[model samples]
Target chain A: MADALLETRALTAGYGEMQVLRDISLAVQPAEIVAIVGSNGAGKTTLLRAISRLIPCGGEVTFDGKSVSHATADEVFGSGLVQVPEGRQLFDRMSVEENLRMGAYRRGDRRAIDDDLDRMYTLFPRLSDRRRQLAGSMSGGEQQMCAMARALMARPRLMMVDEMSLGLAPVIVDQLLETMTAIRKEGVTVLLVEQDVHAALSVADRGYVMETGEIVREGSARELESDPEVQRAYLGEV
Target chain B: MELLAQVLVGGVLLGGLYALMALGLALVWGVLNIVNLSHGALIMLGAYATYYLFTGTGLDPFAALPITAIVLFVIGWLIQRGILNLVIRGPMFNTLLITFGIEVILTYLAQLLFSADFRAINPPYAGNNFRVLGITIPLMQVLAFAIAIGLTVAMWLFLLHTRVGRGIRAASQNLVAARLYGVNPRSIYALTFGIGSALAGVAGGLYGTVSQINPYIGGPLTAKSFAIAIIGGLENPLGVIVGGLVLGIVESLTALYAGSTYRDVASFGVLILVLILRPTGLLGRTT
Candidate 1:
């Protein structure tokens, strides 16, 4: 309860004429890794977009005691709720370095930004070699890494990453998950939405299973993993 | 040989000026996906602004560039905020219609205010020419070309390096990501249109120094700008240089070999060929 940094209560959002997310309520605690696991069209991505204010949403969204119900996407990020959107939407024409710089697009602390740049290069050394290359020229794995690094540059308190493991090698996924663990270690809360149920539960502190625009089950990651129904439905362990 | 060199030089200079003319339109086209039909009319207004600044205040045309740019920037900002913003999210055809209407209105306003008479900005250095490497270059033309190229480079650097510039570039790709970066869309949209207009103002001012301007010149100028933008690719600001130089040299050679009357035919012919061949433009991305 003390760590509840972000809370969405009875949130409802959808596209024109059709509702994708219905009465969704979720909360992320300080420095915790919360994973939302679901299949395609389960409204996991919609939940994140609703929280980030990308689409029109109803119900109250609060981040660190501030209301963001009517806030713009920029204001949400400004309030320290940043999202790495689904698919690596990297600025294709911009250089890798420039893309990373854009991550701090709202920050005014010049000295801290330079320090973060060094830290990013250190974490993902592969990016250092391709710093001058256009982001579009990078492989999927590299672009994913760049996207994460760019989001990190925002220095957000709560980082929401969508489809992090999509179109990447297993090794890259493991590496990225490991990086996420390290980021969580830095005391930044993370909300990860993924379709890979096994990998997501394996890494998350807690997990929520979404089905058809509703949270069917939510508990500690270990409890959810051990739950017979989840094992049968998601992990195919029947 | 000297005549050939002179034509090449003149063509390159003219191309630089042409690039400046197209730069603003290309910017609005690339970012907002709005093919601003009124872009040339904005340029026409810029030329008049520069003209009046010179005639009324005795300010040097080149020196009045900042003023002209500011004035045009405000005009563009208002147009976007007042008019374009309302229908920005609407269909592309509607946007085209609206911009065409803007073009007509601007043309009529310029005609009413400045009259239908042709005007030129003839500073003291307008008639001066210098020989560079055995080829003669008009000083005014040289200055215009230099400033044009300089501004393009500056724009490229700004979009590449600066925060607002990067935000604009990011917004161009996906407004969602840009918004995640704290970009206020309405204001940023206004700012982008303003910057585009500012660039047009500088180009118009430069054009005034080298050519005759009247209310009716906007349509042809707008057509030429489209050709350059299509040829140059909108991916990078520097692409305009390639587009401008190609059109400039082609027009220059056409005027030399074919006849001055055939310049428009050659320009439009190349444009059509490029459209038929590489629709994404030479420098634009294939995908």
Candidate 2:
């Protein structure tokens, strides 16, 4: 726990006067896939936003053993905590290759950056075919792949993916889940936030169940997947 | 027929300068989403900076352009970082009011410092004109046109190819996503505003070589720039050229046919027509 790659203590955030998250604490160890699953409006997205420093939050967020609670969003990202925000926010007018280049914006190693570009192309072969194509023109599934690939180009130590499976076909979601597992194997820790509890727990090493801005349960992925209450409420089983 | 051709030639040259004038405005509006009312004042400052450099040090007005641009860029950077960034995320009207206030303050400062007299950068060749194919062309207009086009192309290439340019583009499109790539919005916004101001300054310097400059010039010039940006649309980098040419030709034709006093009427009329017919601009995507 002391070596957790990302840790938040009593994290709370909200829009002006409308609190969305409350006293939520979580941790992701190095190279592990930690999933936070809940239904709609369970503050899953808010938690990710708070961790990324996109929105103001109360409580402590420590990444790589540094207190990033007061760090700006760019500073957080610069220190290798990156996020593929909800809704695949690709630069709509830029080419797919340009979008990938933006990922390594802070890096100055020209040759290494180029090598990473090639790796991204190989990782997401579909992106290679449409390198010159505008990012906004891609299908939802392809855009999702591009988003993940874009984040990977940053060479992040911790990648927080928000709603990766949102609005995608089941098969595409499965493919993306496999990609997340492959990413973890590359030694990058993941904090996956999802609304689809079943899909999230299937690939997570450990899981936390959120309900209305609070962690209702915490256990190993297998236990959460089989929890009677979790199954009845989230898995749509009796 | 000969007179008409002469007017067309003059219009084309004038249009090129107009394109450069609107380029800065378009960049700020398109990227920072700040419809900078102070743009013309920035342009006016550039003209004065060039004027001072010429009168004070005997530097050629054209040669003083880079100096003027740098001065304007720093002023712009400070203005954004020190003032505009605070209210940037607030209501659009707040920025509008603040920029308008800046324009007023700059105009009064220029008047107080430089006097209300009209100043012209009369380089030795200011009155030199040459006739080609029965069409007369001023030497200064040609030089201004060439420089304007060159800068416009340079800006387009910078936005398309450079790393900082890419950051500006990405930041403009999505601030949150840009942050994920280590883009600091506060600094990026200030940088963008600085670039926009520098372009405006360059355009002002060019304008001084070809015409008279006074403290009151900012208002009409800002209006013209708005017309050009709106007519051209903010979608493409080069669209300003088309918009400028349209306005220049329309103004030239109006001046010849309906007298010089009607030129403003003609330009604004075209602006209204463009707004009604195609609000996105000539090259703007319909979607």
Candidate 3:
């Protein structure tokens, strides 16, 4: 709690006249993989949106000890709190290389940016192979890789990824989760949202069960996985 | 046969400039999603700016293009920041109505300040012509065409290579993700509009050398520009060039064979045909 890099308290957010998040609160510490698992319409994406300031929210959001509650998405990102949004929102018209270049949009260190690009290419060989192709032309799995690599270009301190496994093959999802662990080991904190309870809990050091809009249960990964209620509700195990 | 070759040459020259004229509109619509009904008005203002520079400062219209473009860029930035930015996310209808109002106001102001009289930028080389392969090419038309193609290529390169250009493309694709990359949408939007207006200014400068311009030309010019942009699609700058050339050839051929009175009929007829046949333009991929 003392080393919390990103924290949200009493965060309430929604579209106009329709409140979706009610008194939600959570946090991610440095160099940790935290997952939020929930079902459809469970406000998982909305929480990420609120933290990134894509939508208006009422709460206290602090990143690295700065108030990010009212910050715009760019400002939030500037403060090292970034999100690889759901749906792999790559610039479809742009080439894969260009899309990756866009990830390092704010940084001015030319040599480092180039190095990061090389590093990303190494991490995702498929992307490197299809660097000249349009982002839209790639398959869904390739797009997700590009999206993650693009986010990594920002060198985010707190990276929040929404729906890591959505619409991806089980094998690709496993590969991506392994990469997430490696990313965490490299000192970047991660907050992930996913619908796959088993996969989400497997990689996460800490996990939260989100229902409707509020955090219903919060504990270590083991606690959430072993709980009868969580297993019945989310995990397929009877 | 000679006359037909000359007409075809003339159409090619005119079409190059026409593509330039529609490019700024395409950019604004493509990135900012603003229809920019006042695009032609901005072009008109640029022509007036070039005209004044030529008339008052004795500067050649072609040489004074950068000055006109820079001035229009500033004006465009202001318009986006102060006026259009307020209602940018409100509704497409709101932007359309606002730009339409701006068009009317700009036209009226031009009439008030510069008078309703038509003006042409007739410089030293204005009357010069050269014969290439038995076709007479007006010096001004050739210069305008060259500059138009050059600028279009330059714009394409800038968008493809520059950091700001990448940001604009990203923002257009996904505003939320663009923000995560540290792009301020408001400023980026303004920058896009500014670039669009600057292109319009350059186009206007070129247009003044080829034909006459007045305050009231904005409406028809805007309509023509929109038609070309639709035909070209906003996918690539060269596509616009193709669209402009196609429209230009059709108009010239129609004028020669169907009479000048049927020029609009031919141009708009192609517009209708493209709309019915391929709404995404010839080059634009279906999404």
TM-score of the A-chain for all models: 0.98, 0.99, 0.98
Could you give candidate 3's per-residue lDDT for residues A84-121 as a string of tens digits? 99998888988888888888898899899999989998
C-alpha lDDT (0 to 100) for residue B143 of candidate 3: 96
lDDT for predicted candidate 1 compared with the true structure: 0.91
Candidate 2 per-residue C-alpha lDDT over B1-287 given as tens digits, one digit per residue, 9 for 90 to 100: 99999999999999999999999998888878889999999999999999999999999999999999999999999999999989988899999999999999999999999999999998998999999988899999999999998999899899888999899888878878998779998888888899999999999999999999999899888889999999888866688998999999999999999999999999999999999998988888411
**Per-residue accuracy of model 1 over A95-145 as CA lDDT, tens digit each:** 899889989988999999999999999999999999999898899999999
Question: What are the chain B TM-scores of all models?
Answer: 0.98, 0.97, 0.97
Most TM-score-accurate candidate:
2
Which stretches in model 1 have alpha-carbon errors above 4 Å?
A1-3, B132-135
Taking the true A–B contacts (Cα pairs closer than 8 Å), what share appears in each candidate?
A: 0.67, 0.82, 0.82
Query: What DockQ do the predictions score, one after another?
Result: 0.57, 0.66, 0.67
In model 1, pairs of residues that clash are none
The DockQ score of candidate 3 comes to 0.67
Say what the interface RMSD of candidate 3 is. 2.5
Off by over 4 Å in 2: B285-287
Count of steric clashes across candidates, in order: 0, 0, 0
- Sort the candidates on lDDT, descending order: 2, 1, 3
Tens digits of lDDT, candidate 3, B45-138: 9999999999999998888999999999999999999999899888899999999999999999999999999899999879999888888888
Better of 1 and 3 by TM-score: 3
Q: Once model 2 is optimally superposed onto the true structure by TM-score, how far is the C-alpha of residue A160 displaced, in angstroms?
A: 0.7
